[model samples]
Target: MFDLDRWIEIFQTLSKNKLRTVLSGFTIAFAILLFTLLFGIGNGLKHTFEEQFKGDAQNSIYIRSGRTTKPYKGLQSGRRIQFRNEDSKFMNDKFSEKIQFFSPNIERFNVQAIYKGEQNSYTVRGVYPDYQALEEAVMEQGRFLSVLDIKNKAKVVAIGRLVEKDLYGQLSALGKNITLGGISYKVIGVFSDPGGDNDERFIYTPFTTAQGIYKPNDEVDRYGLTFNPSLSVDQALSFSNLLTKLLKEKHNVDPRDQRAIRVQNYAEGTKNVEQFMGVLNIIILFIGIGTLVAGIIGISNIMVYIVKERTKELGIRKALGATPKSIIGMIMMESIFVTALAGYAGLLLGVFTLNALGDSLEKYFILNPSVETYVVVGATIILIIAGTVAGYIPAKRAARIKPIVALNDE
Candidate 1:
């Protein structure tokens, strides 16, 4: 079955048409290359989003206030609304069983912090002890706010990793004084965040202390609540609905007003991420298939042309007692050889490009590049099928041509 003469003859014919063969092969290679890169970037986007989600409990819910949308029980629209600390207290008292962590957050505007002469402008957050758990903060040095610190309205502060790096220089931050809004506060802890782009350029202090010192207006921006992780997604949903209703009544807004207050549901957010990822993958798959189909069509057209050019040679072989099966075998072998070489070459090129860019991608890109074993296997099978189908029709046409007609034309 492995005829050296037959192989030599096929190679010789292809070599004679070098430019045409290269063009055909290039089509398949580009198809695979584009497919690989698109899918890699899509996966990278999904990975970035998933990393953002990992910064907090997936079952958590966020409640923030915005201006009222509709006239609420005769109150005019365009009124600025505020969520108070008492609202957070009310939730803890009412939903003690459902809620895991409750933190009322208040923001200080454009606070200037100074450490030894280095100055930085950062937002100051007033939070309870549980805020650390909600933010997924890892303490780098010293400790986070203890219960006593929040209870007694101590002036203890926690600095983010970036903040520490900018201010502390070579010295440790613990037990040092950092001035916020011209008031000196002792640094109690230094912290780091897993997600690099997020707002870790701040200082956190006790909510009560912040209310008394900076924001005496007592109007807080938002309240954050995380449910017990052991709770089901449905259970989280139920809690969110209940909290939304309770907050609406407390804020004196119409319960039906969709924009009166915003409650960001983690379950819905997770679902949206999955749906987006699915759409991206479907798009990638279709583009890849389309490219490959074009290449296959090109292969089919070239094979037909090759058959036309070799008519006289096929006729001579047929007259000399070569079977139709042998003729088909010769065509199929050439098709397979071209398909495998081009496809494998394209695959290697894609992998090499990805490897070269992987580190730079990880630093500046939000997406992950992935190539599974099954994907490779699937591509290989698709290439084989494409080659076989392209060869089949032309070989059949050659077998049908009578030896007398083919020889007379030559």
Candidate 2:
């Protein structure tokens, strides 16, 4: 497939009118560069979203109590709804077969933690064992709370990396005693998270331990639940609705009081995220194509000017028995060489720049870089088509020029 002679001819022709060819090539190259950057950013966003979803069950549903906006079952509007441990137990026992994992969250604020007289203020959580999976925490030392810890209201605690650094400094925190809210708990685990500041500012203990130590009178804040993996989206929605109605009835509240209890469905979140990304991709694609169109127009104009300058040469060739096909092929070769070389250069430059920026760029904007294969392929095809079209009109006009008329013209 390599045609060294033909390529030499293309280079020779390009060298004759260096400025014009360079300008055309620059247009195509700039277009490719702009397109590559847009697509790279789009892909990055997709990657970041995927990573974020990994931290929690994408199909999980969360239930939280809120104030009623409308009167329900003799209760007045503005009444605050509360969910207790009994509600969580009821959901687990009633829907055991439908559920995969479930937990109740009890969180308190501004807990003072002290280790060897050094102190810091952080949020403390009383969480079930499943909180490890729910929050996607990775323990760096010892272990998370076990079932026995919860049952016995053990004094063992798991602290975040931020807490460990503040309390222990460079010293190992495992097996050490730290006083939280004036009650001492043995440090059983130190953990890390992707949740940034929020994760760093929280400590975890067994739910029972936390409740007994902190807010023994307050109800649990929310219920976190994930259904069996085999469940369909529609089925999950229906099942969640049924569970919501049962909970409303049990609490002596009206079923239709949306504000009294809120159910957050990951399936719905997923649908919304998909639709949003779809619209975003369409806009990005249009911008890329629009730039390419401008580049194509530039290429077309340059080819027309080059053809005009070569009118006499083309006429001499025609009189010497050169066919119209040969003339068209020569013009096309020049166009293809210029566009392909510039476009490829632009693509490489864009890719290199993005790769260098990597996670740093992503972290700043809370997005990820994730360019896909199909986009690169699509851009290449567009380059070729634009090149061919740009050359065609000028090539046809040159082929029609009469030898006598072309020679007579200045």
Candidate 3:
């Protein structure tokens, strides 16, 4: 199996046509490199898109009030639609089983926040305890708002990381007091949001406290609702539609007026994004496979030319009692050696490029572009099979050469 003479002959044949061999190897290498990079880029794009949805629950919906644009039941066309605390309670009573988490918000924009002598204006909102999970807020230093805080109407506040930096300036913000609009509240938590600095500039307080001190009239600005996780995307959207219709009827808003109530279903958005990414992946796969097929065809054509040029040598070996199997094996071995080396080089270069650029690309949301181990193994197996197939036809032709005819050719 380890024939030194056979190895010497193979090396000698390859060395005779160095330029042609290098060109053949380059074609295979380029194909593999292109495929690996395309696949890596596709994965990076998918990762980036997923990051954009990390700020909220996958099955969440946001409902906000707007002015009615159409007349209904003899009401005027320009009636301002508003949600109240009573509506939130009614929805909880009606859909307790279908709902997972619900939060009613009342917001005051450009509220001045003061800690010690430093003061800055930020958006302040009143929300229930469940708003923490609904907004995907991670506690960096202290605990989030508790249900007890909401029920007791405690004057406690949860500030974001950016707010903590601005007000407290590297000091422990937990258990400290911060004044909002001349009203002092104890800091109970500091949170970080995945949506970056914009989401991290707000302050959260108990809805009851805000309603009591600010609105005092039971007015709600918006509602955040998340359905049971077991529900499908379409089912969740249907439930949201039903809830919207009921709210419109109850508030005397026109059912056909889309402007009266704005509902944003994150699940529906995620589905559309996934569908687009699926099409993108298919396109990349097609291009990669097409390039690889072209390279394999080139290898096959080169093998045919090599065989034709070596006809005289093959015939002389046949006359010296060489068997058809030996001739075929020689040709196949050369093809496999060349393709395997080229494919390996391509794999290494592709992985190295991704690793070198991973850090720089993270700002653009393209992170950790890589191919899996199984994929690399699969590509190698495919290369070996392709090599065998590429040489098969030429190997057969070499085996069929007549010793006398081949030797007589000029």
Candidate 4:
């Protein structure tokens, strides 16, 4: 199967025709390179979209209250709506099955947290044990807030990893006392969040402890909960809508009031994200298909031109008693070889470029741009096949032509 003389002849021809070789190689290489880069950038965009939405649980919903914007049931438009422990109980009693991991929050910003001589301003939240899941916090050093801690109003806190680092330096914050607003709480845990730095800088304390210390009575600032994961996006939206409507009615707000009670549903935003991602996928697929088609066409035309330019040479071979099969085989082999080399070169170059880029494109939201190895290899094979087919047609035509006519052409 290994024909040494044929290979030598092929190499000799390629080396002698430098322009032809470079033209063919460049066509295949550029096509493959373009396709790889475009696909990598598209995937980078997809990664950016995913990262943007990873700040909270995918099924999360937040309920917050503001002053009523419209009068209803004799209530004035300027009435300030509020969430309370009674509202939390009402939600649990009414929508127990629809809700998952509910938490009533009492949040305070610019809280001065002091540990020994170190002090910093941070956001502190009083939350239920289930708040860990709501915030998607993972316990790194110890345990999160327990139900017993909430019931007993324990002076214990779960500090974020960044909070611990900022105050405790390299020393562990676990079991240490941190004073917030002159009230000292023992650090029972340290947590990390995928939600990034801002989330990481928060301090979580037992709901009852913070509530008793900060609130006038049983007041809650806001509520956060995740819906049942089994629910479809439409079902989740419906659940949130019903919950919003009921909350509005319970508060005596107008049905059309926009600011009295508001629900922020992650699922609603995810629906738009899904739609955009679908359109994006279609666009990427279209671009890839279009690029492959253009590459095939370009290589096919170039192969045909190469054959035309060598018509006299082919005629000379025919006169020397070379068979039609040998003629087609030689041309096809050269075209395939060139295409294979160029394609591989493109693949390596594309991968190297992506690696060299690293996270430098993060500002542009193009993180870790790359293409799968199999994908690039398959694309290269396709080009090689296209080159063979392109060379076959013209080679067959050249072989059929009378040797005298080909040699006589000016």
Predicted model with the maximum TM-score: 4
- lDDT computed for candidate 4: 0.92
Mind giving the per-residue lDDT tens digits that candidate 2 earns over 112-171? Answer: 999997998889888888888767788989999899998999999999988999889999
* lDDT of prediction 2: 0.82
Q: Which digits, one per residue and each the tens of the lDDT, describe model 3 over residues 101-208?
A: 899998999999999999999999999989987888999988888889999999999999999999889798899999999999999999999878988998999999
RMSD of each: 5.2, 4.1, 2.9, 2.3
Q: What lDDT score is found at residue 264 in candidate 3?
A: 91
Candidate 2 has a TM-score of 0.80
Q: Which runs of model 3 end up more than 4 angstroms from their true locations?
A: 1-9, 319-323, 351-377, 400-410
* Backbone clash pairs in model 4 (N, Cα, C under 3 Å; residues 3+ apart or in different chains), count: 0
lDDT of each: 0.80, 0.82, 0.87, 0.92
Q: For candidate 4, what is the TM-score?
A: 0.92
> At residue 121, what lDDT does model 3 achieve?
98
Among all windows of ten consecutive residues in candidate 2, which has the lowest summed lDDT?
A: 362-371
lDDT of 4 by residue, 1-410 (tens): 99999999999999999999999899899888888887788788888888887868999999999999887887789899988899999999999998989999999999999998999999999999999998889999999999999999999999999999999999999999999999989999999999999999999999899999999689999999999998999999999999999999898889899888989999998999899889987898788878878989999999999999999999899999999999999999999999999998988888888888869989998877888788888888898999999999999999898899889866
- Structure candidate 3, residue pairs in collision: none
- TM-score per model over all chains: 0.72, 0.80, 0.89, 0.92
Candidate 1 least-lDDT 10 residues: 365-374
